[model samples]
Target: MNLFNANETKAQFILSLLPITLFFPIGIGYTGIVLFFVALLAGGQYRDKWQAIKDSPMFFPVMGLLTVTCCAGLLLERPDGFWKAFMHYQIYLVLLVFISVGAGYWQQRALRVFFAGAVLASTLLYLNAFQLLPDWSLFQNYRMYAGNKSILIGILLGIAGGWMLNQICANHGHKWLRISMWLYVAVALLFLAKTRTGSLIFVFGCALVLLRYLTFSWRSVLLVIGTVIILGVAWQTATGFRERLVGTVSDIKAFVDGGKVSADGIRLEMYRITTDIIKEHPVVGSGVGTWAIKYPERAQGLMSAEMATPHNDYLLYAAEIGAIGVCALLWIWLTQLFVAIKIGGENGMRLFTIGIAIMFGGLVNAILRDALFGIAFMILLAIPLAGISRHNYKSHFGDLDR
Candidate 1:
């Protein structure tokens, strides 16, 4: 029997628009989230929702992380900090809601919506990069109307690139088109956006896709070699790319030689301070939201600007919630990857690509700490996982209303 009534159906429809909204301004995405929650409450079916949440493999790990953060916050007498952390981590509840109510059809629809949004956003960015767009200040300098940072845009594009790569691998319709789209995404990330983390994500995602789909062969070897040659040529010729690469190396060398904190130097300093903090509170961490409190105190006159996180997700978690929180974080990522692999379809490939992006991207940025990346990560993860779960359910029990 259909569990959804008219109100519930409307709620689902609103939920389906989330991916597209994410490509808009952040406030619009937040508004959409708020509206969806309100609609969900108006169409409540508590019993079924609870069952769905309980059945999700992600439930325990997510809850565990939440519990740890909450406890750390409360016990450490940092209610304000706890509240702040909760604000960031509350995106997980969105994922839970997705598993509870999102149907396979809606999930697929959402993925398609996301892909379309990505394409449109990419096209605009490309136009803006080339100064082809009307000289609106808002659209200038590769700035996205979505108001996301270039790095975040690159990561999102990397996710889209991964999806296209999967489609090409599966021999889906319009093979050349998919290949062209994939290349387009690569160019956007590596050239136009010029985000190092994004470029790394694209490269890493390509490796993962090829590893998953291709058997070891001479053709694969040649393909890899050719890719390397292209990258080498780009490195030599692309001014922005070469400068960023050279700048990163220079930043590290400057930091090591004279402790001069530059672009990457700030990250190194934060990592250094965070590691000390972790050593002191290795077990339970300094507690939720302690990084903002602790890092400045430790760095003192060393860092020029205030930083909330260490800019590295693993280190941030380890410093805030300790090793246990780190474990929970890893569990969340690994479990999601496992599910994506088990599903092993186009949707699975999409999820897998996102997983790679967040996991690798986390090394350079505190991915979950950022509003855009965090929200995108959870929603994208939930959509694909929900679809996979629905498929598994139908396989075992036959199709229901969903």
Candidate 2:
């Protein structure tokens, strides 16, 4: 019995409760995305339907890479265990993408306000993470928020940055709003810098995008962003940033050369093993779930840790399904970036999406830590996407925007 189509008024009533942002049904964000897409499809919407999803100019080519990669993985690796895990991966990532495209239907005004709320939500959580505020004991125990500081900060700043830029674009008739956005940037930087080691640098990346919108003169904006980057790089180097990045590896020369590092080490040893395995089975992989197996010893000796999968998400993809699998993963990323960059007229929603892609897309490295972060960044970023026109809803049968 499909609750969406069910004749029972009670079932429809329950369905209505699903979209409320107030009731963030934890552990079920994926379900929300899926239902939203189903609602769009079943409602019989049609205004530039295909254009909305996979929006980038080069989206089709990226999708081609994605399809080819997944095909190779499935054909080369016949492991049932890998299949089972991959099925789950597909379900969530697919829905996450759906949310991205579907967000365009949400409307320009609501997108900005909704994303502002999202930024507030992220800021509060981050403050908690720093213990400047209350820590979410639940998140600590659940460990689902993707233990990745860089990605989190990036998403927070990116969304906030986008919404702020959208305000500048919307030309809210107040010069103060633009100044307020710059202030928002400062607050965003405080949180981002404190958390991620590389994030301080990423701020320049954010500045570049902000520059584009800061002045109508694209060239001037570029110059401002470029100057900031040059200064940042010089200062970072003068202060021995390269050394600071060494982190746990700094004290341990052996690990740097041929000894051992750790998760703080980014568990590079696991990556070495995964890469080696790929060499032996380049055409396919050891199997999806099989990465959990013990890695063969390197020249030094037996591997130290018994990590099931490579810590790096992309490497995990390549290892599980080989080159083809990695292609699929990259394809999804490329497609997302393209769509986020596409302009949807003079509205806050387009600006917000572009900003998010910048902040989140720039740190593809975080995917190495948690696939969930990647998904969450893409998924939650949708709140700011412009809504479909009422015309499209009529095409979708009876789809209601509310």
Q: Which candidate achieves the best TM-score against the true structure?
A: 1
| Worst ten in a row by lDDT for model 1 | 393-402
Model 2 compared with the native: what TM-score?
Answer: 0.61
Q: Which stretches of candidate 2 lie above 4 Å from their native place?
A: 1-28, 34-66, 69-74, 88-110, 122-154, 162-172, 185-189, 192-194, 197-204, 210-256, 259-263, 294-308, 335-371, 380-402
Score candidate 2 by lDDT.
Answer: 0.46
lDDT of 2 by residue, 67-119 (tens): 65466555654444555555534533443334333432233333434445445
The number of clashing residue pairs in model 2 is 18
Question: Once all C-alphas are superposed, what RMSD does model 2 give against the true structure?
Answer: 8.1
lDDT of 1 by residue, 1-402 (tens): 223335336667667778876655567778988998888788778797777787777788789878877777667636356677756755576688866774545565566677777777678778877767776553443554232365666677777767666666666676667667766666666666657776677677777777777758775666567557756766776678678778888888887787575654577777777899899889888777777877777777775238767788899888878898888789888877787777676666667788878888788887888777888777777666663342253211112121
